[model samples]
Target chain A: MIRAVLALARSDLFRWHRSPALVAATLIPALSMGVMVVALTYAVGRQPVALVIEDHGPVADHIIQIIRESDGFFLVERTREEALADMKAQRVAAVITIPAGFEDRVGSHDAKLDVFINNVDLDFSDDVRRSINEAVVEVDAPSLATLGENDLPPGTVSGIPNPYRIDVAERDLRTPDVSFLAYQMVPVLALLSLTAGALVTALAIAGEREVGALRLVRLSPVPRTAVVAGRLLGGTVASGALLSAVVLAATLTDVLSPPAGRWPLLMLLLLVTAVGSVGLGVLVGLLTRRVTTTAMLGVNVATASFLLGGGFTTIAFLPDFVQGVARAFPTYYAVEGVREVLFYDSMPTLGRNLAALTATAVVSLVVGSVALARVSARPH
Target chain B: MSSWWRAFDGGLRTQLRSFLRTPMTAFLVLILPINLLLLLSLFALTGYNAPTALVMGEDTAAARSYVEALEDTHNSFELRPMDLATAQDQLKRARLVAILEIPPGFEAGVQAGHTVPVNLTLDNVNLDMAEDVRRAVPAAAVIFAARNAFPEVRIEADLRNLLPRDTGYVQYLGVSAVALAACIAGAVLGGTVTAREWELGTARLSQLAPGGAAAVLAGRLAAAAVAGVVASSVTALIVWFGYSVHPVHPLEVGLTLVATVFACTMLGGLVGAGLRRVMPVAPLLIGTLLPFYLDSGALEPQRFDGEWLFALAHLSPTYYSVGVMEHAYHGLVVTPEPRWLLLLALVAIGLASLAALPRVARR
Candidate 1:
């Protein structure tokens, strides 16, 4: 049985290799996903702002120094006009204007400040607002400390305490090196499963029809179940090898640094996902008798699934309703399952996803088998 | 009087009928952009508070009071109490786009007449959102602090707010639909109807007819352009009427249709003629072309930032088609308006035809 599956898998893999277009389909998505991850990471990290100081006073200077110390922002002193121009150009992400007399006014209890931002760039504007507000809160920190002893609330800190306690816990399971690789690699899992699921079933059945092979296979005494299983095995092997290569590349390159205990479980998850993908492909092929229609449907579903499943962006940031809408697609599960393996180092949730995927596979296999059986049983 | 005109008319009618038949083509043509416009308008329903963050100095009840105050104050924000790393991750995903970190010595700094260090982590991906969070958070924090500390020094923000009115994902989608129409037309007809003829070796027989190779190629291009224009125009009209999207100009809108058809024809015809087989290569063509469709600002364009992507967008005839459509929707004065956009479109269409001519002529 192992040898048969292996033989089927090897043939399917070779078919992919021989077909230049199929090879391009898989390779382009993998590369595209890698590029997208880098773009997102860089976009997230590079946050710079323009700082406008209306008061060039000693106290305002002290606040500017504190702003410089934060390391969260880059402060460039520019006029209001300069800042607005820069913000419009997207050269400066946001603008912070420290109002005139900002420092002395804080002691007088009438401190007022104004900040300007180009609302077109929503993310950076939000960040600048937060940073500048914190700076204001910090400026008022000194004056508020000097009031009467009773003026302070119980928990309000008037001064430093005894021993400062610091506890650090790393919630991200993947290491930085693997984190980057995991970032690049995770997108492929979705690309592979959807492509594999749709392709295997469609091509296997369609190619047989084209070559007059399905007609002959139906004439044989071998149960239609055997033929369907054989094709499923072939698809599983192809998808498995492709997925395993991605895992091996990520692992070797330090992109997938799974905890030692989780290795067995991760492998199981990969195998199950591949099986489910193949079942989906077979079902698509069986339903769409025409080769062209099957192939088109396969590409459409694969591409659309990747975009809508939150594989490219975080699900949380998307509108509240879109997230729920995203879950209805299987691509979401593939991504969520893989993300769990990489981020949490746990597999039971992945196991549940695998179970769900397996159920989907079983149903697809049964439906595909019935459909193919009927088509084969026909006179033509 | 001319055979070319007859071929063109024949090509247009056959193409239009075939286009109207497919549910996929018709749906994408008529519904996708309109649906997107409706989706974008949903953003006008404001008062949905983005989840916010507050870093606590003492990690005690007072900190809870501070966070609860923020929550109760506005319908626009929900405060999340978190540590530095969690806050950082939230900001990274634009989840908690703003984070208020109360330093270890925050309360102590307040008491000693020292600078109390409070850090606000801002997600700068959306610059506007970052700025709003920056201003609103500090103002809220200072107001609370004023009631506690120096009650005399009332801190108020005279905000110079110049925020862009919220535009919908649908507007963006409306921009993308123009590009999608070209791709769908290319996918449905390009190189296929004609390439299918060539694959079946009917090209030789057609070449032997009275008008010959030029006439056949003209007919094929006419068919493709008609399909491309109708699909794109239908989508555009739906966007205009259904969503009230205003184009940069009526001429630019017409130009968008022309440019997309030319692009679809050149790319699809070139691929169709170049590949020898009909069935296998068709899937390959669709797969390879599929990315260009999605990537070409059809769904979203600004997310990618390589020089290659920029250069590709500039070079794409579809990009100009989409750009013209965008200018129309946004009503941007394209310098001298229609003249410059038309000149560029003509030059692009001319170049596209020239590139394909050599390849088709050899066949």
Candidate 2:
């Protein structure tokens, strides 16, 4: 039985090696994920804002300096007319204008700075608002001294040195802040393994069925269970090899870190994920019976799994209902587990995630084997 | 003229009949775009609500008031009251965006006219959301300080939005979603319809039957373009009426949609002719469209991102399509000379289509 399984698995691998298009199809998710990560790095944060400084006062210059020094605003110095035109053209997200005599009115408590924002996306506009507010606070209430000093009348709030001043200090939980690209790349790795395993397995079996080789196999003495196990093993090996190369490349490129001491656990999780994916692929192959249809089904299933499994965005950020829906996909557990082991250095729900993946693998394998046996039993 | 008309009519009818015969064709043509739009919109709607935990170590009147102050500040944080241990666990798992820890003696220090520092422990995995939390915390503090202490300091900073009204992030993304739908529909339908002929060995029959292959190809292209336009329009209407994203110039948006459909269909036809396989069309279209969507000023102005990205955006038709749609829908000229760029794209794609069709028909 072991010999027959090894022979069948070898043949499956040999057939896949002959088809470059099938290999290319399996690599599509990884390629797309790479492009998305690069694009996302450029897409988020530090929006462009045109700065029109009409005031030459010391305080106004200080405000301008503060805005320049801040990390949130990519400042473009422009004249008022130019700034307005740029804002209208959507070339810049917001326009900040420092009015003339803005410094002179500071002691009188009537200083006002105008901000014209293109509020197409409130998320971005809110960033601009916060940056401006920070600038104001820096100028007016430096070190909490000027919070209540300049504006107080002679005796109203007498000797009450800034009745109340709030100081905010933020600490990041992650030791080294994860870039958006790094954060998204972990799930992309899982997606790669899932897609490759499922696609290769489905296409291998479906291609055999399409060419009438499956009928010959049934006519032979090899059991159907051996054929199914062989195909699944072949697919798992191919997917595991491909994913290992991707991880190695990512580590070399500094896109991801090495697994450190968690390599064994990571390998185990990836192995389980690949087995589950191969089982699904075999079932799809048995159902479709055509290479093209099987490939299409594999692509669709992979895409759906990727989207719902937090491949593109964090699942925690999604709506409650969508998060609930995400729990159904095995890819979610694979991604969640991989991310924890790789980045967080601790597996919080390792048991639950492993159980889900193991169940998926067992169920899919059983159902797929039964279906293959039934199909093989028919007289051809 | 009569021969051309007959060939076009026959080809259109044949293409339509062929497409209707396959249920998968209908699903790809009609259902996929709507699904993508709905999914992408759902994604856009999320991630805006930053989950935060408020830990009140000192439960005093001032602490309670400060908590209330954070709550009242716009959709900044979805606050949950939890102990420090639970907050730490949640933060580690990235379940919460941040934890605003109000240390003991916060109220006492504030009431004694001293500076009370609030520690905000953040999970900076998503920098965009982290920036939101970082800025929001200080803004809320300023509001609290202004109301309590600085009564005479009246700094009236007038905020004038360039648009007539504020557009939510999801609404802004809806315009791009329509373009994405058009791109996918045009590519998948046009590619599949053209490629399936060769895959099923029906191209020879078409070649043997009638007038020049160009005319037949034109007819097929017309049918696919129409399907693309109709499917994308359904998505647009959902975004417009269902999502309350009313375009300022509805007629202009209609015109832009037609142009986008034509351009994308022709492009897809070129790819179909080149690949000449049914199975590769979907994956190829998806892979090609994703990068284009990202670099196409869909999220923000592409030029502002960087010079490298701006250079890449010029190569994608979706960029010009998104630019034209943004202008037509929201009156914001996100790209320079968008109408001219779209016209150039349409002409280029039309020429490319004419060149690629003979190759496909001959195959």
What would you estimate as the lDDT of candidate 2? 0.74
C-alpha lDDT score of every prediction, in listed order: 0.55, 0.74
* lDDT tens digits by residue: candidate 2, B8-71: 8888888778667755646546666676676666556654667898898889988887887677
What value does the lDDT take at residue A271 in candidate 2? 86
Fnat of every candidate, listed in order: 0.19, 0.55
Candidate 1 residue lDDT tens string, A162-200 = 111110111221222233335435646777765664575
With candidate 2 superimposed using the best TM-score fit, by how many Å does residue B100's alpha carbon deviate from the native? 1.3
Q: What is candidate 1's CAPRI-style docking category based on DockQ?
A: incorrect
| Model 1 chain B poorest 10 in a row by lDDT | B38-47
Tens digits of per-residue lDDT for model 1, B1-363: 476566545555655566566545344433433332333233212213556676676764434444554564333366677777888665654355566666566455545544443444444333233334434544455545544554433445454545444234455555556555555565445656556556557666666646565566566666666665766677677777766777658777776667666666666666666654444444455444444443444432332223355455554455555546656575432112253664476457645754775476476
